[model samples]
Target chain A: MESPSKTYQPTSTPFDVDAIRRDFPILERKVLGKPLVYLDNAATTQKPSAVIQSITDYYTQINSNVHRGVHHLSEEATNAYEGAREKVRQFLNAGSVEEIIFTKGTTGGINLVASAWGRKHLKAGDEVLVSGMEHHSNIVPWQMICSEKGAHLKVIPINQQGELDMDQYTSLLNERTRLVALVHISNALGSINPVRRMIEMAHRKDIPVLIDGAQAAPHLAIDVRDLDCDFYAFSGHKMYGPTGIGGLFVKKAWLEKMDPYQGGGEMIKSVTFEKTVYHDLPHRFEAGTPNIAGAIGLGAAIDYLRAIGYDSILAYESDLQAYASEKIGSIPGVRLIGTAHDKAGVVSFVVEQVHPLDLGTMLNAAGIAIRTGHHCAQPVMDFYRIPGTARASLGIYNTRAEIDHLAETTRETIKLLS
Target chain B: MNSTKVAENSIQAAQDSIIEDFELLEDWTEKYKYIIELGQVSPGLPEALKTPDIKIKGCQSNVWLHTELKDGKIVFSGDSDAMITKGLINLLINVLSDREPREILEGDLYFIDRIGMKQHLSPTRANGLASMIKQMKIYALAYKTKLENAN
Candidate 1:
């Protein structure tokens, strides 16, 4: 009575993905004498020429120090760097530019929150609630801080579908819960949690929440105002930009109360032997000279994405997800790992008797690159009782044709392996 | 008494033979196929001998190794969960298993790069290969110390 394409909901926007693919030069290359089908976007997306040019533009022209420098080059460089912060503010829909802090990556952003905000707010007996499906970046930072403060670190369990157990999460919240940090979308399993509901629940108990948006930023549209979350964090490289750059979106209220993440130049207004006063908002958190070119590149990436429009990206990716879930999911010997009803840009799976590493290697030989192993979320793998899953995560540029190739390749590999 | 042992020529001849055999293979796929075939001939570790203490640490695939000293030769047996890794382990065992501790410690093992294996292996497997060789050398050094003490 049902059809396979029943779940495939076509989006409103008309997408020209072939034109988009042409923008990324690496997509035109070959992997193993065959066309490269890059399904590793969740690991790191391929940068477009626009983003690459922005980086080159920085080096070729307007290359200088930011903030403290008075020279012409410094002003130009500082303008570009600060302009990137404004882009991030607009990108996340955060309240102000002052609320956006530059970081090394998502790990650095999470660590900054744990160190600066956690030190002032948390104490012994307080609990930091995190979901079971967090990447090590989210888990370890909270773990480090919780352990340091003699506070307990509580976990929100996940069901077999890899969705967070809301009943358990709600039950665990109490007067002792100081804060909650959850992933926007799980990198390992493509489950998108009901973060708005969870954030509201936490706010009821006066507990601030931090959403790790590393995986979600590239796939979904995020609005800090709509989510009403206290903090949001994401990396630039995962969004088709340069590496060594990411941003943390903290609410102005939280910024006012929290101490500086690091003590160094620029973070301080004036330094004396016995007296030191810190700067305001974002700069208070970012201590050293920031990644000037990387931030500018990230800004360019945002501009490119904005031009394509999120609606088009969403529609295209959903089409890819539905197609992948059906085609790749239906293959013989392939057991789809995460089958959450509300899923996003990834299809994680395993073939019978074939280790993920072997499967990935065989696929690589076929010139299809899919990520293998724990995906830096070992707890998620442990929960699933798996060594790892071979993941094919989608980006805006991925096509349904590529999905068919993936399914065909996987089916052939399974037969060969079996 | 030593249960089973190969001839003196067999241990050293294995490396030369493998290099010659790999030269016949045309591409990475063929080399990999040959490697998987080689895993079939590997002297798998006994259930009792597959102890956690002797497992290779850095390999992405789990590999258990056991070693012994017979007539001053460093006898070895190993197994891996993955066929390709198992084959690679078997190839190592064939070449260096029964060679003298000092010979293994000083052996070049140039055949890794000579047969284009260095280029073919993935980054993790390359690290695993280096770790395997390092672990083998560590075992030889221990035996070398024991042999010296016995003197």
Candidate 2:
């Protein structure tokens, strides 16, 4: 008898997905008396044993506050923390380590930029341009800053296929446009935006751009210098790293001019009754004692990804995405929401007369985890006039058989509900 | 006994019957299938009554609940876009609807727990089962106060 969870072998590829699955311990676990089929990678990826071990090693061996103490343990802790920043710098191909600022997550990174940069530059009637497919994290921060500064928040619309209207995006760029913030990939729709071209368009107008790479960093190889995006924000957890640790990449020029994000211990050079001078580039924004263990864990995650290489990851995922799109789209009453030409390994669909919540609950009973909701992209949902979508986002560890199981169960669920 | 006392006893009896029915089901699929059947058979709230004012917030699916004081009992009519949520709503309506406001206000819904559907009652469950129960109790409290004012 053939195993239901048999690994799908790709012809003549060095990408051994079965071997990769062993790195993630959670994949071996069971949910609801069935093998767990995790399809919620867009929400957060499962951590590898290497990443977990790095975090454990930090707490067990090198546990101390960074930068302040003259003690040996402090130096070791600071080295590990700063080492993680260097790893992130390499991961994004950022010019310097000074360009990386540790943040709480993608939300925190965007909020920092909105507070620090927008507060200084934005004036009344100025506009911040964002796409309709942006996550709430990318949209809300700009809205908050815009409302405060009396600036306008303009949206570049997306078509029914979930691709951004590049013509409208170009027109939206004008003298009033202070900054353009865009998502590299839409989390809800799975559409990978042409960010490189968009960044060039913004640059042509001499307007700075911020790319929310929260979804992109996990799947794509980021080259900050090549893209030339002024600001790039990504969460570590999305890329199989620890929660509460992420990186924000700002150009050196902007970092030098922007105001400090927060005022506290690590951010300051010296503090007195009078005025206090802030620290250099990245440290000025760090403020408090950061997530030291999380940073170390993220470093390990970066190392693990580099070992597998992005070329193999992208190729394998493209195949998986194609398989999922074909198999899932063929189901009756299941309409694929985002039919963009370019997409990540994510399938967002809605079944006729079957709400996403119902489908999600039924799938959970079968031990298949998926994300169901507006995916924090309410504007995208509003554009499509859907309540939500049942999203199955793939990770590097996912198999073709798992996708087959998903499609089969989804068909059964729809039948049972109908 | 008074009518309110009889209504409370009926609510308990209805919950026991639901628990007994659920216990006979083999697994989650069977249990939810039964719920789905109940949802299919249950009458929907009139489209005119599904206004934003009556819609319950925080539910992943759109759910609208309408309540009225008919005679001495509070009647609830609710509907949800999701079948499972609608089924849960129908179950609640069965146990608590068409009962005296006093009975509804005091009735503890233990059937959801006894039937292995305790997850629905969790505050974080996007179905908003807990919120629906709370909203129903709020309606009962308001109707009870109205009765007192009228007397």
Candidate 3:
């Protein structure tokens, strides 16, 4: 495997990180009397002022139930809510607005497909393929549905560098393979899977694919149509939007055929004691009162990302990741966990004789927040034969100086613990 | 003093000394350094005793605690993968170990709070500090039952 630093040449384009940092209000706050250096982006990103204000505006101005009432407030609420759907549709470059279904987050989206699609299509002895690097969200839903359907859940193994074994993945694809669900970018190892090629491989076998884009959506520009995935799920919170609201982008063909995930008022076109008619594409999947403000906030988040552009985000973050890997890995006992050729800005490592939880606590005292433990990827931990790792995931707002501090503090903490 | 009173006084005395030691530390780093040193010197449970049955749940790191009744007193030994968690386990053992079941069950450990380690006791922290304390008392309750039955 090639070193990640050498794989991507750092762009010479200037990135205004200081100006970007000012956009997040929470960045001004200090932790433990020290200025905060938040590196837990893979868990959740800090919301910009625009996203925060959008949520505030929704409650303060509109504050009405959507798609039900005929009053002026309802009309405004309906437009804003539906407008957010349009924003998501454009964000993923999906074929139509009907493809975007509002969900609780990535977990909700995966569960929706695993229930609605899996229950309808899967048969006994059928197999669902998922990568070893998947977050628990991507793995458990399939496990539940597969067990219920008398189907099996098969894992596509990963190599030492945390890259998926492409040959093994191809061999795993067989006649009994019903679906392929994989994470676009690993939250634990920062490995960027060859998802596009993998999708094409599955397509050749007439098997549909679902891409868990929770980690990818914040960093990469997504085009669901280009990827041609059957389903793409992501979280709003991980992409500078409000929590409890996310999207599932299903292909139109699948949406037209799959059953409604839940039955409730908004999901029905007409209801009677004897019979009820389910609503159209997206609304059929979204039941009950939706997260109206959350959707609006996510729309504002999309607008913010579009204004800055993905070109700069990718270049700046890639450079930052490479720099971090070098600096942190230079420490005597520090071992970089993920050395994939292609990766996002997540850097996972473990120090010899120093537990990740101990490292995380010490860093917290210095106001440098990083995620520790198995990172909800226990299978990945088992593969490495270690308990867990200390992960410092980068975001667009982070600076090189923060990485420098992180490296220095990590060195001191390791010495103290050892 | 009677043996039971002696055991109770020793537990309180141990906690007070711990508090005094922590008070001398200047900053968070110094306090943590001292705790790590304590963990290094702590006698860990035997490998055979560190089984899944004794492992504490809800900890980010693995923690194994073993309790045994020796000469009418409960003896506690524990281990953790993380140094800080191990340090905390050592402190807990120091305050509660090698005491009669009734004395162990009735002991109120205030050193963690007095030494500014209250955050570790929060349920959300998931470091197993609170769980370890609860487990030690539970072992005491079980041993107390055994003593009553034997009598």
Candidate 4:
């Protein structure tokens, strides 16, 4: 709970980020012998050497199935794997490790909720509210659940800033609203939701809330206790951990009420030929063999992040985002999307006449990695009435020099395409 | 581009001889043109699949694919918001469907590079193409080898 000093900005942080780029081994490699400048952090962040080593250490030193075995290697693996759970608990500042249930990234976590909670609590004519800015992972699960239960799915609209209209959201929330699942930070547009307020507003109507923290987990500090949302979901890969690992944090009360998501090995306590008793909260949701290596790697990613400090990382990233926005905003025919007052590290844009796919290709040739298209937020695109945008998302490792290169390359690309 | 035409001609020639001899066409050019033509055949996407949930990321054009497997062959029906991309997808469906499980399992997508399309795509579109290819290949791989054996 110790906070880093506000004035303690490190001067050792390079002005020319290229000088500090050596820390990332992947950046050292060339794309066609051109140095790799990765900017697609919103899609997934590249692993640092520390994270890579941590995964290697686990496999080399303690590579056994976790939790079930009573032997030495099994004990070591369980501790290491559960130790990662504790790290996740601390990272999100959740009350207990039991609150964090690992799954196959955000999509799986959301599906777990839909299948488990939606089937049990939701009935025909109930409504599930979502924002226009949600990823498909967040949107489709609710749609599927609604379609099955005959429940309705409603959307909160977005303005030019990409921020959801709170007034409209409030109006949409009636007694029939069963749940409201929203994105904490938009991956397509950099809009950061007022989650604390959103959670409070939904709770007033006795509606349980789920925050899609997939975009927020990497850049911002998450305190579930502070937000007090009923459920939260995030992916490991988006935050510089290994892929195939993510967590769903459910409030203890809600977890108890919901049916088990999947039924398989390790999820059951006692199985007779006639009847089976399910395990307690969290374990009941996590069934079969889990992503042990990925969980351990996620722990390493959290450690690396904590060592650097999230406060400093957030500040540095925010500054860079603002700088890029201002500079990129000045370019002729370049249109910026999602200009919310409070935001995260994503910057989605469109150059006049050039398709995002074409722009992405040209930028890749320049050794820049960017994301293009709807960014899995098709509803957001529909709201804006555009097919998609070219997005450059930042990470802790990104530098201002890269952003400058992005702007310069964007200008050149526009000229070529125009 | 000329080689692509010649390859297409050869594929056509091979097709005329026998369905089994279609594999005799050695290069990607004919395959790519055929792929593009297949895309051209992609039905005008039904307005229904354009729902917020079904949209494919990284595509320059709004493209949607819904697959149904009948008999032994996987039948893909898709549409794109853009004409050229629909053509691109039609090309994809042709290469992706009606292939052996082993061929799909091995995922020899090097054919994309041979056809010169990979070089042309923007990184996002390239990624979309890669993702779409991966999806189709997964269907082929998941085809239960028994299907081929039964046939």
Query: Interface RMSD for candidate number 4?
Result: 7.5
Per-model fnat list: 0.12, 0.68, 0.64, 0.04
**Cα lDDT for residue A156, candidate 1:** 98
Per-residue CA lDDT of candidate 2, range A174-253, in tens? 99999999999989988999999999999999999999999999899999999999999999999999999999999999
Interface RMSD of each: 1.9, 1.1, 1.3, 7.5
The superposed Cα distance between candidate 4 and the true structure at residue A369, in angstroms, equals 0.9
lDDT of 4 by residue, A1-418 (tens): 1111011122234333443354457877877345678999999998767677777777787888877889977888788788888888998889988888998888888999999999999999999999989999999999999999999999998898888899999999999999999999999999999999999999999999999999999999999999999899999999888999998898888887889967898798999999999987678787897888889888888876776677888888999999889878889999999899998989899888766755675577677899888898888898888888999999877887889998998897676544
lDDT of 1 by residue, A236-306 (tens): 99998899999999999999999986888879888999999898778988888889889998888887787
Backbone Cα, N, C clashes tallied per candidate: 0, 0, 0, 9
For all candidates in order, the CA lDDT equals 0.86, 0.89, 0.89, 0.78
Q: What is the lDDT of residue A24 in candidate 3?
A: 88
Q: Estimate each model's TM-score.
A: 0.91, 0.92, 0.92, 0.75
* Lowest lDDT 10-residue stretch of candidate 1 chain A: A3-12
| Backbone clashes (count) for model 1 | 0
Record all residue pairs in model 3 with backbone atoms less than 3 Å apart, i.e. clashing. none
lDDT of 2 by residue, B66-125 (tens): 998789999898999888889989999999999999989888889988887885333566
Task: Report the lDDT of model 2 for residue A409.
Answer: 89
Index of the highest-DockQ prediction? 2
